[model samples]
Target: MSATLKWMWVLAVALATGCGKGATPLPTRLVPTRMPTIAPSPTSTEPGSADSGWVVAARGIEVRNLAVAGVVPDTAAPIYAVRLDPALVRLRVRYAPDTPQLLRTWVAAHHPLVAINGGFFTADNQATALIVADGEAHGASYAGFGGMLAASADGRVWIQALREEPYDPAVRLDQAIQSFPMLVYPGGVVAEISDNGQRARRTAVAMDRAGRLLIIVCPTSAFSLQALATWLASSDLEIDRALNFDGGSSSGLFVDVGDVRWQIDSFTTLPSVLLIEPRTS
Candidate 1:
């Protein structure tokens, strides 16, 4: 068989046997692939500036612009921060079990102002936690992961650690997306980095003090979960609460603002995505 087919056959066998004889391990930290350097924009603001170790990937209106800034905090690997204004944007979760799509394809089909991989999923690409999209709940709440990002019908967005307060779907939330291991809570960083010390490209969804949503993606396989969380908690981004999403080869972000489109494509297919659309009056 060709190398590609051989690899596929091996993968099929592994999946069929469930990788053999061990408890299905929880998802671990990702190790990132090599990434090309992105040049910083000249007009980026301070703290998020080129001189300050951040490269502005995209910048425009807080709402309409796919504003992204890249930074490497202290000794950690590089990470990108995307800011979305909740007031001017609409947030939704997109998923189709029989029709999993690539991140770029989802962007093209939905034409979102901005989009990111939604959350963690099983090997079959099913969401691992409660998923409420368009005000309808798609799955039962699972406590395996304690962090969630939810939005109300009035355009308010918030992130919560469910360990302290269980997720109540009965609440008046218009949309909700859940992921694992709360990274940064209102009190402080809550994630415990594993000593096994695996690293990979990372992705997170957060809300800042001013209620703007932030989608963070690190394309380079460089940061451990603990390192990423620590940087976010201490950084100047003012993130109020942050939740970790699926990463490694599954992490990606896509944004389109007028004539310019900025994208960091994922190597794997994604079952769901958090989409940002313009608020329709």
Candidate 2:
């Protein structure tokens, strides 16, 4: 039998034997007669090419522009592209305004279920938003529980906000959850780990699947959902929804291009996880 055919059979059996949740599809391997090799270029220097601050680890993919940039006061603007790993598909900003109120207004005007209220909250088609949609909890809030897990038009992303208490991993809510760790959004949220191996709870602007914008502003910082929205709309790259995480000393960005990777910013401490930027083509 041909070598290619032999490898195909092996992969087929591997997949056939494994049929359960959270199992990503595997690529069929192929046998080759010749081994691939690349001779080191004479120009290659010794070690320590990169400085002490940043590190480069990803390759092949393209590195686009920075996600955040200065923008006009209040308008829907373009920022940068945030690549969703494993899927090369890019989420461009459909249309986003600045500030929580303006962004909320923009969402309400365009979205089917969006609305505005005292808090300037707005929902997309899913009918979420604490204060936007009618009968929604105007004063809804969350405490201690950190991380931007999921965002839907329903209450899957949010639950009854509680008073600050000790961290609770067993705390449950009635929403489907999706987690993107080490990602930094517009406002200030940084989904990372604390110095003590606990979940880092920061808030910021994040984009949903539909490219809608959402903001999470904590009591700390000069965060004004409305002001941030205004600033974001002025960015050169497009944005959808931008949600905030947490911020303070735990803020940084990492970039990598093949064997060339480094940090864009430095933090006094390492975060639990980091949003890695693979080589952008």
Candidate 3:
């Protein structure tokens, strides 16, 4: 079989979901693949096995790596994240359903300070949940379920669980995307989630009490939704709220802040992505 076809096979197993209602149906327990070869940036202080305390990647940006506890089948998972202070940066949800590209490809096209995979999508690459790009809406919200991360015209960015707080149609949003099962709630509280017993690579979006946006990824197929939620709440990250993104082969992140640079390529191309750039006052 061709390499692309092989990755798709791996992708199917990697899209882990069992978040009750509206969760994408796919197998779980992702098989980690050899990351594409790339030389580390000169300023990149590689994260070792132990936690490399968040390092300043650039103005208003910090990067870190944490080793997650072993699950039933794996010893430890590799977690990487970048924290962005919204006051210094702005977020845009870019949708290109007709022309989805890999994370690296998107970076080459727009050169955002940071970018990561968005929410779920159908097999044909259409976004599964609501997506609003440049004030134009596509797809649909998750009803009284799931959660959304949005940026409004007033320059406000927030993460909300739909079950607790539904989307208000009246609000004008510049960027938004919905995904299943709220992870962390306000006050660093872990959202109650039913553990589905399946593990896969994971991606999530979160905001802290200070309102810094965080794009997180687990490069290994070693975590379940419940496990991830619990970890987020318990970790020192101080997450106020978070939402899960489409995972497995679909998970990826790219960053270019000063001398700090790294690209976590998704096993497959993505239909939508969250782009962050310097906030122009």
Candidate 4:
């Protein structure tokens, strides 16, 4: 079937499912217009750096730092989590404290596509899961680049964005293909390496050794994403589903814990990030 037709069918199903009662409206938050403030850029010079990148949060959001590492590698940043075991993954549904309604409204306006479902993943012209999207970023040398989006049968999601700049078309394509196998599942643990030929930028996102849903951004890249995949394939971890999202200047990750939050941005840098922190009853 044609891609357009497939999407149409999916939308039909979503709306159809809401025909009965108990259909909550899609969250009303558009992607903010203001670029988020990203920490100073890291380099591939050190395979082991103390920098986990930046951690920024919107006001009124409470955050508790949980130390958990080893799920990926210490080469990333300081990891955080709500629980240390897979059983605690349910805390994600609790979400963080609320942000200003205006911010939520804004994100929804710019980001028109949002939903919930069993599986989520996306590539060029095709996306499975709740959302399928395209994202990009700029290199230090300054160039246009893009990446993919993938989601799992569970609610876990991953946004695979290119970390290296000065877009190298050949390397970008190679890395995207390599992303398929670079995942640590059950909680969305991922490893992203740039095509710097030296593995200068390496990042992994997962529930962490602590079971917190996280997006770890690092400064390191191998010749290909396959390098990371190869390592993960041999590990004891079992990844369920994964996806890739926009990277580079467009590469962003946001999380909120009660009144605390952390956000990584490429383009839209804000004093703090206003995100969809679900309510806890």
Candidate 5:
């Protein structure tokens, strides 16, 4: 059941149950490409101080590992986050539902600097929500539910909570991916999730107040949705909007950039992935 394509594809990932009302769309605009920014060499050569233990991995990328202990009652893990400046990093999506593979496989085949598991899918490798790669939409959108990490036609990238910002069909997207049960809202507010105390490995995509993208992963299933959202609200990340990607056995992340090297594989193979590459002028 191997699926091939002339170009990479993307679709949204839907939650298993209930939906929410649409709210306001996020407003993280992509900084334009003036002065040949993000290519060859960036304007600033001085790395930021290692405050908060963040390592500047590349010109516009940073990585950090946080030993979160007692952030929530009986919940903790060594949380990982890769921060990227969209002005210097390009986001792309790859789909191969019929040929599900490991995160390493996607990185090896595409040669991206970083990669992570995308949204949710069914047992048959079918997307449960919507994904728009290169203007081609596939799978059904969550509609008035969940949240989306999407780029408009002019290269503006945003993570919108559908409950606050419902999807507008008239808008053309260059790339987009959706996921269920948004965890954080604007101004660092955590969404209250109702679950029966089930926990799994967690992954999330967030936009910081500075408009930087944060790719977060909790490798251990040690925290529930409420706990994770609580930490995000209290953490120093200053997150403006955040959406939860697929969790449990589908969590994974890979990195191979300046001063950063990692390879965290998921418990199961993945049919879709989000890739990051250095933006060229």
Candidate 6:
């Protein structure tokens, strides 16, 4: 089938499976017209320094080999941010139902530069929300969750709250992944906090003002959902929109840049993984 017709078929399936329902409306906040200025790149004359951001806090560390940088924001949590250029990287989803894979396993198999755990799932390792992998829809659009990360055919990334709008498969998207409880909207922080307010390790996907993809992971068990949102909104990362993924024990990030391999493995295996691979011309 032609690529256009294939997307149309997926849209039909998504609509038939009750794509639009039970949507929690996002708060009507004014989106900022001007983009925030990103900090200058790290000032090290090192090889991977071009991809690194300035060290923010005293505890900040630079994994020069992996092109990853860590910062301790005032929120008291360590956030590792890796910037991936859209022109150089291709984003896609990888899933294995019968045999779920770890972040490292997915990296080794696909040989992506970076990989992170995808959206929430059930005990059977099935994704909870709508998922489009390589122009194919794997599940129906779920309205219960509020946020979605979509990659266009041109490799551009867009993050939005599904509560505000449902996923329209008619749009040209190579990969569309959904998650819950949006961390930061376009204007500012607006995450739905739980009554318990327990702190745990958190993972999030965000787009910076410079149109770069940021895969953030908080390895510390000191940030609650509300706290994490506040930190992200106030940080220097200049994040436009952020989505919270299945965190806690499901939080993980793996990067294999050059000969250096850096990984934060999850306690349990994940059902899906979002990978950033080199774009082949």
Best candidate (score: TM-score): 3
Error of 4 at 136 (Å): 27
TM-score of each: 0.75, 0.30, 0.85, 0.32, 0.80, 0.72
Query: Which portions of model 1 show Cα errors greater than 4 Å?
Result: 1-76, 258-260
Can you give the lDDT of residue 110 in candidate 3? 92
lDDT of 4 by residue, 174-222 (tens): 1111122224333434444333322212233333333333433332122
Which 10-residue span in candidate 3 carries the lowest summed lDDT? Answer: 13-22
Clash pairs for candidate 6: 146-162
lDDT (tens digit, per residue) of candidate 3 on 40-110: 44334332256766888778898887666555344556678889887788888888877878878888999
Candidate 6 matches the true fold with a TM-score of 0.72
lDDT of 4: 0.28
Candidate 5, run of 10 with poorest lDDT: 30-39
Q: Please give the lDDT score at residue 150 for candidate 4.
A: 28
For candidate 2, the lDDT comes to 0.26
lDDT of 1 by residue, 44-95 (tens): 2222223233333334223211122322334334455667777777888887
Error of 4 at 17 (Å): 35
Which scores better on TM-score, 1 or 3? 3
Candidate numbers, best TM-score first, in rank order: 3, 5, 1, 6, 4, 2
Ranking by lDDT: 3, 5, 1, 6, 4, 2
User: Whose lDDT is greatest here?
Assistant: 3
Which ten-residue region of model 6 has the weakest summed lDDT?
A: 28-37
Model 4 poorest 10 in a row by lDDT: 112-121
lDDT (Cα atoms) of all candidates against the true structure:
0.64, 0.26, 0.75, 0.28, 0.70, 0.62
Tell me the TM-score of model 4.
Answer: 0.32
Question: Higher-lDDT candidate among 1 and 2?
Answer: 1
